[model samples]
Target: MRPFPLLLVLLASASLSAADVTPPKGETPPPATDLLGNPTDVPTVSKEEAAVLVVQGKEAMIESNDNPRRSVDAAVAFSKALKYYETTGDTDTICDLEANIFWCKKRMNLDDVKSFVAQKSGDKTVVAALAKVDKVANKEVTADKADEYFSRAEKFASKNPENFEQISVRYFEVAERFVGTEVGIKAQKLSLVAQQNQMKAIKEAQDAQRETLFSKPTKLNGKIQQTAVPSTDTQKSSASSIRTLYKSDFAKRKPNQKQNLLNKLMDQARTTKDDPVMLHALLTAATDLAMECQDFYAVISASDLMAMNFSGVDATAQKKTAFGKSKNPTVLAIIKLLDNPEDGDANTIVGKYFCYEAQKWDLGIPLLMHGTDADMKSLGDMEQLKPDGVAQQIELGDKWYDIGKKGRKGQPTLEGPMGRALYWYQLAEPKITGISKDRIAKRMDEIDSLLPMTNLNYESLTAKQWDRLKGGMAVISAAKDRNDIGLRLTAGKKYRIVPHPTDTWQPTTYYSSGNSRSVNWKGESLTNTPNTRQFIYFTGGDFKEGAMVMQIENGKWMKPGLVEGDGRLWLGPFSDYAWGAGGKGEIRIKILPADDE
Candidate 1:
């Protein structure tokens, strides 16, 4: 089940950073965009990801338990499956057997993991993994019992670092100490030992997984993927330039629908002053649904637009990735909005929405940007102010400007949520009012001019076309042009929910619960299915990370625009064979929430 913001309980075996992971130099494109274009940048898998691997008694992986051919699906199968032995137990390691299988599958397959596991049992790596899984599988250790065991184990382990078997024995002894020596011994020693033995019974599981499960790289099929990174920071940046990594064209997307949706959400919020906690949670969830952002509209609109829908938003923009441009469709959408930025509605919800934001964000921007001529003029030019107000203004102005700068920069490396909140806050008022007519016109022209070079559509597609049906039915949704067959998918769909094969060689995933073993049509079930109805699914996308984009920031380029006028891409799709990318079997995972995450 989905939890509140940043409160996810389990660990996601996040794919590595997409930065270093780019399209293979000489690969061809498949049905989807190249690795770089797919927005499915793998979540950063921290060392914390290892925590989910050691679930209760059983090993977790991406596959279901019922698959006789579990090997094929083992890599994505739960992470715990690889912890089938004592060697890895209690080590807090990433070396789950399933993890090894996943890596091998990506490179070689389960065969590699099996062979790897076959190494001498005494191998330090193997032993640590066994130990880690043992602890996760245990569900009954009480607090009192746990504490008792903790002290004993700590004493024993600290004294004997070299003696693992002794440490292992002590670990269990302490654990069992909680339920009284007898019960603890039975659970820790007998039950755990038995569980460990059971895991090993399937000795060939790793090998089989390696053979059937293979990870395809995310290569751009036949497109000229001239990969480059933002070597250094430049002075100026904009929304479009910020999120340039995915190679999208947001302008062609339909507009009014966005406004309509945002309008609808604001209505609901005012009508029902719901409980703030639940409301906040609901709001976050609702906002997430609207993540299918093309530009800025999706960003701010999401907050006010969905109070009416229980359906949960599916395609709005993400605020986390909001600031400058790339992951944030809002900024781009917002800039598009600011084009004719004067006069917001005094009565209508939309008017008030922007008004509210402008009031908030503007409070900071002009204060910082305009500067104080003196307090007396009061920002109209201003007059002298008391020293205290001056100090306060400076502090306040700094606060707002910092946020404003972040919004412009797109991605600020600075820490703290206040900075983030303020970034959004500064834009609330002002509503780009100070953006003179010349700047607005110039901004529009500059944004639109790049559209042709990208050779992509900016219009939103109708929902009729982008039906995201479940099952093997992938969104066979077509792009605006052939060259962009999979390149740019407008925010809205134009087609009905058609059944396209979701399981492509490109990154594909299965949505199921209950160990994945229970509900998977493929006949596998995940073990710990959250009780709440949740979308446990995955997708085929490029698993690359840390890639940079050609963007400008604060009048300079945060990264070079080498790819900005990357003249060659305009010719069309990766399949063109015009550039280095386009190859087959080069796709990774792109997971979409049954709703939106």
Candidate 2:
């Protein structure tokens, strides 16, 4: 999940009154215009009329949640109130009213009352809309043509087997042009294979050069010398020798002997250079001995040194090479932790190694929180000074949630700070009741939404297609030429829609307040409610208000999903309230045919 900007949230929820629209005493207001300073023919109203309209809009908006039909009334009232503010040249109130009008229209389709009714009674319009989209999305590609295209690429690859770079590019082009077809999928896979082969060839060439250089005889100090390159066997032998020099059975050794050995390992680490395997062995021994002796600082020192020396090195391969096939519990746990930090048992063991054995509270807490062991959990609870009362527990949960929301410092852990917050919330869940329970549950839901989803994969594409997906096509404003993608979508086809990371725009310049306060493709919600629901009453009812909305050949607006029917594609920010006017910036979107279709 992406971070929500606090300033946008504040702006969305803020309210304005008639007083905000009134000019200061003895000050002349500017001429009527929109928030962007464009000239407008806003008819003036009496102060009494403006105040009454504001009150009516507020009342209607408040009642609309319970009776969604009242949203139309609320929208009308806010629109009139906005005109009055516009006449007074009050930019702040005009901006507030514009946003309120947007919320009113949004609620007309998304309020719980209306949504429940639609669900129970079946909305014909929704069914029709979906059917229309599906009709276009399900359109089949010309299989024979796609096959012919793919065959040519395959023949090219067969002819130029050693030209992996050219072969990959050919396959990638076929994959991109005929995406969503079986031949396209095959082409994409082959493209990946060709790229991999190319990389392997490059690596092999580099390795051969290194071998020739190392084995070559060179003159040094008036004498010819042959340099021996380190091999797998040589590295293993060096590591073994270093271990033998430092290793001692902790159970058989006295405290002074263990300390002496630890000191010797540290001294070796300080002097060690030009030999990574020896350094790894020395640090690994020091870490294990430090844990055995319950020395927090020493364990941290060893771990830190190991990480510094092995930056960018494949950690799993390095550990496996250093401690090959070791069955020692500590060694196994370290390997498992490195391979999969989220493994509960591995986390528990490592947690104990840090919290109990080494007494490094900061490093151990996150692991213990993620671990399944009851004793370790209790230890973690004690480390945090867990309170007994339900109220206190909720407070603690909130505290952690806030910390996680703000994010953590230093190297990121697997469970993450949000996971830690979730740990506390889960603990408080069963203990609370009524509104408190509901609040906790809501918070937990938010955290769940915010937490990263594992194993989520998108449709496979070639490197060129992947680049296009990430690069995105820009949709600037609501103009036909700017928003249209020129490609027609079929009814039965599924497409993945992703907002470009850097593409942001304000639906109205009023929200900018003379700064670059633009929002992402996912627009800000002006209400307390989650801005994730579709506004089915509008053209883009398939997407939430403020999100990037699309239309099929100027038909009903929809978001990323299976095409309902065939039509030309058009994309833009959701700006129905402004009637697709007065917005700054552009929205870039990536459209790809989903493999599931």
Candidate 3:
């Protein structure tokens, strides 16, 4: 807001001096292990020498006139001299020679030293020098020269002690350093950006993974069992990175990281082979990383399966079909594992499921069709959408939401935004025959409105939830979408998973053999008979009969029906015993203002 000329003058001075910066000692410090990783090492100067050095440097800067370049040179010299003095502490370098350097011949300048002192390290002698330089930059010095001088001045000021913006300056300096460099300047810049982004991604992913894997804790039998890896995020990131880098011309370039992602992936596939429906996330994660560094470019040379590397290893010729073919060994192994003793197309059904879920839908759909002798429409409505699509992606999100809510006890655990969304999704599903179409439509609508805002995923679901909802629900394995989570509860027994926010808890004080009704709708044991019966459902609103929120009228799991009268909500199937399910112990869902009763 200052006038243009004054602004320009301030700008010129700003280039050289932002604020007070303590000058470096004239002598360099002793060659300590360059602890800060900088190029140079210097020793500390004697107090007397450091003081004198500041005075002389002040004098030099003051007399630099309009020349920012000269000012910068003087500052650099001062810095170097400080380095040298600290290194040797020679009395001459430290003190006497400093006064003579600026005062030699016709340049015996005094007034300038005072200004320099006031502007720089605040030593009196340099105040005169600063005033002189400021005057020069304001009047005699051209704009360009002022900029140059200011830049130098800023550089000097940057070296001042107690300047915490070192990292910010370092970035600009690095950018400037590469301004006219020969090789890979642009590439380096791009790579720098990518590296930053990659770091952010690595951090977030590792954080989320750790959070999911270790989100909850409970005293099980008065003993604690750890279900998740303990702060091994760095290791996982390293593994993930290795695979990502490998996916990009890995054979041509050696992987900088050391973890063997491919081997880990194969091992995961082997162990998880039996669970054809389970999404083996570790395997997929390893695959994601390996793909980043692996050779995707297919060569035209005559080749066996190993001749063309899509994955890390040289594949066997038995796996070969033609050139540039990416035959997934994991998928194949999974397919082999799924081939069943029970029936003809059951194995292929599993294969189709995994293939499609893996996003190799092209491969999976075909396989499924071959076995079924019909199009995929019969299995389920085959609607594939890009990760962000409304119909496909949103619906997918909603489905995951439901799995977290309605799943059985002691299996998958999920909470938080992910849990809330999953709860919403669970509440949304059409209960084929149990609930009417209108209710399903209304709940689905509610879920649709929620998922976009929540941004939850499947993996965030507990391992148990993942198994029952995704694994048990789907005939084949679901695709492991990085964008969407595929949760599974691994060690619920090890950790304490309490009630989630969306849970509907029905306190059982009584039980009956038949509820005095013809049909026992919800299959619950009728053992105890407590007069006080309470069915608690975590719906945001109360449930009325025939409402989608809860079938107060006879619905799935509720045999005789629930009746509300006189502010008393009667929840039934009138069972004496009720089973409870807690998600994997690793996940915890603390509602907003968490636990604020």
Candidate 4:
């Protein structure tokens, strides 16, 4: 279980204990100043003598530095001196002695210092000082635990290098368990490196095994001989037989062995001339193996190959069976690799899945929408390539919109259903025409209306506020080049400005999503050339350098744009404060809100 609240624990630990005293047992004695009007047990020591005791205790404490045994002696001296000071009624000296004793206990066992101080006094100043000590002690414990976990993870990896999954999981656990510590951060980075190396080793070992199997001398007619020339027919025959290649022993093999067999099949496919069925099968198996291997780059290559070929081939009965066995692996592998790639045409495979599989719209729509003009031309007629892609979007939108209406009655979770419905509807708008377009637009607007409103007039917004406006809107001033016009945001919000109608944003096309039209400082539409918004639209400052927008806060500047969302470049949460920046443009900020939002 998590630890108790810090403040509560400290407060409880700092409470003072009861005073120590002894009562007479077996006899009752009563006297008023011993019948002589004098207080019993009053100290007769002079003020000078008490002062000397305090000086001696101070000397002892100063000498105890870095000497824990000596610290105990100092505590003893302070305890003895405390009585003298108490008799003299020098409260400051008494308090000083109590604090010295606490320090002595800390030097012996820092963890016990809190309890020791609490037993002595309930002085807030003493408790406050002890709290700082407690923090350092707690930090020390955390650091030790983090280091121990890190060491264990390292030793486990070293002792069991073959257990990549287990080792990586353990390392990641250390990273997460001690999240903010130096050891945890190092463990996190080391875990990533370990994963990368494991993947590389797997790839290298596979290559070596392939060389051993395929590079050997061929045995022909009982005579072993190396062939200098490659056989084209042999390659073709290998491609034709891939379906039956591993069928005999396939079910008996382990995952890694299965991976090796699939690798051989892929190798055969690579060497053979174009055979659509074999290519599709190989692509399917490659994707499955890549997923299992957690080889992200391989998934990207496989997805690219499938997208460029799968649509052109008619599936054979065997191919259909293989595809069925693959369980639509391309969709999953593509989703994993989508954000990692900088350039690729994933439209064909993504569109096919979007059409037939009826999954992956969260991933597929962005790939299609962000396609360059070349990508669009590559599709010929989008309808011919996949009719159901558009239909699926509409179907999903309707389904989710119904869920929005029915699920949770009224709650934030409504966004899950309605936002998804709007997402599909909006994605389909640009691809379809006429009533279809109008229908999508209408549904999107209706969903948007029901969604929550974000008040952006504030200089900065929190992550929750940012999430509320995702696939929604912000009410703010019109586009202008002034600090007052910009939003103060952090990396977590990661908002980027774009032109409202542009379908995307760039540093060269920065503007507010809140108000599209150029307006005066009050945000009222300004009198200017009708298309003046486009000319005055803010473009090219820091965003062109990379960030989509620059923030200016209190005469300081910061930039946001660390990660990509759907098609938009969004910034991550800031590590430090980001000041707002001012720019004028007709462009507006648009974010491809995360699905979980």
Which structure is stronger by TM-score: 1 or 2?
A: 2
lDDT of 1 at 200: 51
Identify the candidate with maximal lDDT: 2
Better model by TM-score, 3 or 4? 4
lDDT of 3 by residue, 61-123 (tens): 333432332343244334434444545656444332232222221122233333444344443
Give candidate 3 regions above 4 Å deviation.
Answer: 1-142, 145-313, 316-597
Provide the global lDDT of candidate 1 against the true structure. 0.28
In candidate 4, where is summed lDDT lowest over 10 consecutive residues? Answer: 1-10
TM-score: model 2 vs. ground truth: 0.26
Query: For candidate 1, lDDT tens digit of each residue in 1-597?
Result: 101111101123332221112223563211232232212211222222333332321221212222222322233323323322323354323323422332222222333334434442323332233222222333245655555555555555567554333344344434333555554554355434433443453334432322200011122224222222221232123222423522332222444344334334334433544333333333343343344423223344443333233224222223324333353332443333333222122112222222223323222222222222232113212211111122233334344334333443222222221232232222221223344434433433332322221111112211221232222222211121111112222333221212111112111222222223122111112132121112333312221111111111112211111122211111111111111122122111111222110
Best by TM-score: 2
Q: Report the candidate with higher lDDT, 2 versus 3.
A: 2
* TM-score (all chains, Cα) for each model: 0.22, 0.26, 0.19, 0.22
Decoy 4 TM-score against native: 0.22
Candidate 1: regions farther than 4 A off? 1-79, 82-90, 94-177, 180-563, 570-597
- Tens digits of lDDT, candidate 2, 265-304: 8888867767777776787778667656645346545655
